[model samples]
Target: MQIQDLPYPDPGVPDARSGPRFLWWLFRNQLGGQVRSLAWGLVHFLSVSALPFCVGYAVQAVVDRSGTRLALAGGLLALACAGNAIGDTFLHRAAITNWITAAARVQQLLARKAATLGSALTRRVAAGEVVAVSTGDVEKIGWFVEAVSRFTAAALTILFVCVGLVVYQPSLGVVVAVGLPVLALAVLPLLPRATRRADFQREKAGRATELASDTVAGLRVLRGIGGEELFLDRYRSASQEVRHAAVRSARMWSLISAIQVLLPGLLLIAVVWHGVGLAREGRISVGELVTVYSSVMVMTYPLRHFEEIAMAYSFSRPSARRAARVLSLRRATSEDGSQAGTAPKGDLYDPATGLLAPTGRFTAVVCGDPDAAGRLAERLGGHPSSTEEEPSVLLGGVPLDELPLSAARTAVLVQDKDPVLLSGTLRELLDVPASGDVDAREALTAAQCEDVLAALVQGSLGAEDPLDARITERGRSLSGGQRQRLALARSLFTDPEVLVLDEPTSAVDSHTEARVAEGVRELRAGRTTVVFTSSPLLLDRADRVVLVHEGEVVAVGVHRDLVHKEPRYRAVVTRETEPEPEEPHDLQELEELEEIEETA
Candidate 1:
């Protein structure tokens, strides 16, 4: 395939069981491209090999003093030169196409795998290792794939030349044939040592990269606590380790390179020495002697490809292994089987927690244990903990865990308690895979971010539009409340069939939280939403409230009724120290409610 047609429609599922299998899978999928490259490589190798024979023919013709022979040799030389040029051009073109397409395919697969794994990817795979695999290892893998075809052609050309030489002149031919194979195989003994050193270098580099990443990510915190120098010193030590390992690996590879040159030089000397002896005994002509000498030189060129392919394989094998490990990670509660495309249309229920959020209602959940709250919220969205054997969250009549990942995601979206905001423009941050029904401004308004856009614009780097303003990494430039609201806005933009939010407004002030609660109630009208919070502002807005204690649902009722009638629910929400609050305290609490403002 051409480079322009690349990044294939889908990178197809990878055979990620092992490194060798994954590498084989990549190469096999690109068989058509590889075959074409192999053909061009063959042309290049054969044409290059033909040049030596053509020169020898011309030499013999000149000695014979025959004009016709001289003219014929000249014509053949021109043809061989033309063939050589054409073959080299196409060989390089095809090889490059193979390399880029293979890498692009791998990139797509890794991206798909990452999307499937979500936040869990970093948990299972080191962040630095993932970065390293994506950035550097991908190219090395593609290089090996591209090298395989050329190496085959080189080996074939070597065999073909050896046979031709033997038929032309036996005594000299034997030496050339034996010496060429020796030159190719001589570096094999050193490869394992070189590869071990290379692997050590890669490991050191991955650790150093992880250290640097962690240092950068926590730089602000480190500076706050005055621990900057400590981290810097640690990273410095890691960088030194990486440098040392790289030097050791380079030393081993350098030895291999020296052997590549030394062996070929020795082979050339042996061929020439034998050819001269044969010529003296009248067993070979001057032209024949010249042919054997030149043939050895030609044969030595393709031998370099052998060493290159070996190095490529050594580098790429480990790369493929790492990529495979990442790709093989499966979500603990997700299924990859057939599923309906449409979202389930009914109540959301978590069987283990016995929490029921009825259809088309605003439900607020109060969990006495914060840990329990987090777990329930994630479980509601089908992201159950791997160690727990909880029953699947159900929707309509279907278990979400049994549904396809995309279908399950479409049915419900759970905004984590601590939502992360990646660095990007405000517009890009909100540019998520969504139902596309809710407008960004509408979601922003619903999340009570009416002032956030203005703030972004004021702090923007010359950008007049708030949506176009750049957000620093982790939204560090924005306040905690602003970040939380923006995250809530992003979730609202998706407009899913059911939305579960965990401590979504914990960072906002009481007044703003009240407005946000009302806004959410209005915006999510006629849709199901489960909000996990003990804040009366949000709970009072709920059409129904659920009280869970120690992971089990203990009570369910209207917020005001539950506060007055249910002691356990009241204690959890009010943080009660007495049997009940005083009359004035009750009055204050009632007035603060303002009763959720009837959804705007």
Candidate 2:
């Protein structure tokens, strides 16, 4: 599958409210399990509430001078504690299990969507954003999902306590009922700011992650150009920004936490003060007031949860939005075309440009702009380029866009100038998909990789089997020419009906590149191949060459013929030979051309 055909997402401006909506979607889908989790949580919470009741009972029993009743109350208290412990253990385990499984499922779905969207995914979203979603964001989403039942149980417990208090002691109960809402709702004003700060923190974190990834990826280039220190300084600056954002986020959460603690304490003081006045007036008994005090203290636990839920939601909402954005990307599929599994017989036709790459022929396309050639290669390989007009690229007579991805891939392949070589053995490096049972010997010979194999052999103890020798990541262990030949050999082994190579030997010397052109022709005989290159040797070898100037084909002929016939083609192929404004002598121009050609 080509990368450009991978699904791309069009995530509009992310709504702050999307987090709640996402949670609701998850909740609805897992309602049965959620209900069970909530039920267990409630049982556990109610069992806990028994502690306060037992204290209230024991106080009354002692006041009444009933030893037997006091003993029974203590026993009841022990039983309630045991039940709460058991229930809480199971409750936590069940809830956490649900959260993990749900998160895993969502991540899997996102990964599948990403694969379908292919290269388009990276085009729309930063690599770091995708990384964050899979790692950090997924876990945050899970926490929010599991927090649901716990939060619900806490809310219910609060409601139950308020009603019970009112029934037991009407005056104290009224204050307790009124104050609980104040504790729960007091943090509302700070929530918006906290969430905004959290979002900023997450965004900065993602950017830092992206910067780090980019820096690591180009570390070799950066070092070669003496720009490593410059990048390091930039990264340090980005880190400082992240640190500041985190501090702001932490401050907001801390303020919410302070209110969570202070407000409840203030409510407790108010309840105790009012309860004592009523007791002095003979409206309520001492034991009842003690019960009221115990209840208010217990109420602190649930109020603490209010603060916890707020903080968790604040952090997790942005994460969920990020994950949602990734998930929402649609895989690239043809909108209007036949879904035929069959491939066209010969040649590739770009209807938009009226260009044809004839079957079983070596066609050289010379674009005035290198970028234009790259775009054309991308389109020919059944993928979209960043061209303003969405044009159809046809393989044989059938539109490439119309064919199923598998068919399109089998029939056409585009080898980019710089292709990725994953870390593995030499054999694995040349083992292209669908090229089954192709020994390393045949492919190495075809791409003239004898030097590459010899290098692998001389480097290590396990030298007899060069294919088994380990390749460093990105083939950094090998020279540029060796890497290019290995990539070319891998592509040759695939033996696609139509092979499109974009400057396959751009990094190699003339000797190796000329050999590669010869090897490519010998190995891919009677197969349609289009090479986008300005190399004299490769162009000379083409059966028919097409020179594209300013996005249109201006001349069609062999390399020597075009060099003699087309001035633009000559200037491009021998760019280094062209007399510079500063040095216009023919002798100097010839010297420069010889030097450039000799270097190549």
Candidate 3:
């Protein structure tokens, strides 16, 4: 495959049972490639095993009485070396190819799963965890997968060497055959502790990554509230924890490396000592002794691979489990299975709040608690808007969960108060995904975005087309009101069957806000539109306003009608209208709500 076509692997199963299983499943699927690589590796390794024998033959010939025989043995040794070099080159390349492709496949699976789960993925798994899994974890899995072939090649070569030694010198061969097993199995006792340490280190690293992501995403708000220091301190603590875990993990690995080295060295020494004795007793010739020594020495190469495979697996198994958990997440709850792609053919209803938004009407949800109002809007659009409760939101008499994700999203579009201002031009921001189908000009007019268009034409830095002018990330360059208007324009452009707007005009001036409220009512005359706002101007425009108090709709009517009939609704809206000091009682809570709006 070409470099550009390299597939990104995304194996999202992160649970304990799923990690190894995912690898196994992938192995089964790619068994043919693996088998081909394995066959090549075996041939390469077998050819490589002839080097020590050739060296022994050359040594014996030089020690004996002939010049021509010595030259012939030397030539054979050179041929063996050349053969080994060629075999090793192809073996390494084939192994690496398998590793890279496997990693790419895993990454692809993960990306697919992330898209399938979308917003829900973050709600369940931390953003950092996903990032780490897609990057570092996948590489580790690939290492382990590739290590399998290396370990197999090493084991087979070692066995061949040991058997050859036994034929050359029975006494030394027996010593080697028995000692190799000891070196391979000796590290078993320490493996459990090493695996545990590696797992702990990985967990801390994931946490540190998550903390950094959160810090960066909230850097703007954190700076606004002067909480950067607090978050920085938290991040420092997380980093320190990761450092400690890494150090512990390093210590374990260092110890294992030492054992791997010492055990092989000791075995070599014992085998040599036994071979020397056999040679002195006249049971073995000098060339045979050299052959025995050479065989044991060559065996060290394979043993090292054995240890490497163990270490690779020690880290990868847990990482695979984490990836498995993410992939295993079902796209949607099965309870909503029957309702998917089917509609109830009536108005939408929320069971928890006892709020009903009739189909094809301009309804306003006025909540005394802004949090409650935001949550209500989320439920109406099929997102879990409640923290402690899963409110039931129905569309056309059918539950939102019952509708397929696409159907639900198409039927009801919740334009959050603070719409996400992606890095693009004002035109692109307003274009949205459905711009081609909807009338962009009409939507812009309804959203009162004439100023936005003027700014794009006059102030944009690049691209002559106003629609093509690029905006900065999060639209930080634009005023809050401009961003809100652009988001409103985008939502209106969708022309969804049900349009839910949460505090849609929070950043605009009263006059502009009045125009937007009126424009929205005029544009969505027959469609189901729910506006979550307490602005008297917007509320007055609502055909009917449902007053939400303590998570329940206590009163329902027009703005003036509710102010007269519901005392709590009047107080809440009045409080919001009144100007207060910069330090609001629930300042943090209010800021979070604003941030949520910005994300819409």
Q: Output the number of the TM-score-best candidate.
A: 1
TM-score of each candidate? 0.87, 0.84, 0.83
Clashes of each: 0, 8, 32
Q: State the lDDT of candidate 1 residue by residue for 467-492, as single tens digits.
A: 89888889888888999999999999
lDDT of 2 at 3: 20
TM-score for model 2?
0.84
Stretch of 10 with least lDDT, candidate 3: 331-340
**Where does the lowest 10-residue lDDT sum fall in candidate 2?**
1-10
Task: Note the Cα lDDT for every prediction shown.
Answer: 0.88, 0.79, 0.78
lDDT of 3: 0.78
Per-residue lDDT tens digits of candidate 2, residues 1-600? Answer: 112322323212222246677766766655666777788887788777768878988998999999998999999999988888887987887687667755765676677656555555676788778888898888888787778878898899899989998998999999999999888999999999999999999999989988988898778789899999999998999999999999999998999988888988898899889989999999988778888888888878767777777877888888888877776654344422235576677778776655678899999888868878887787788777433366677766687766777677778888877777889888777666644634556667878889888887777576578888777888887887888888888888877888899998888899888888888887777889999999998998898898877766778888888898889999899884656566546888889888999999
| lDDT value, candidate 1, whole model | 0.88
- Identify the superior model by lDDT, candidate 1 or candidate 3: 1
Give the per-residue lDDT of model 3 (tens digit) for 421-538. Answer: 7886656666545625568788889999888877866767666776787777877767889989988988998888888999999989999999998899988888889999888989
Q: Of the pair 2 and 3, which is ahead by lDDT? A: 2
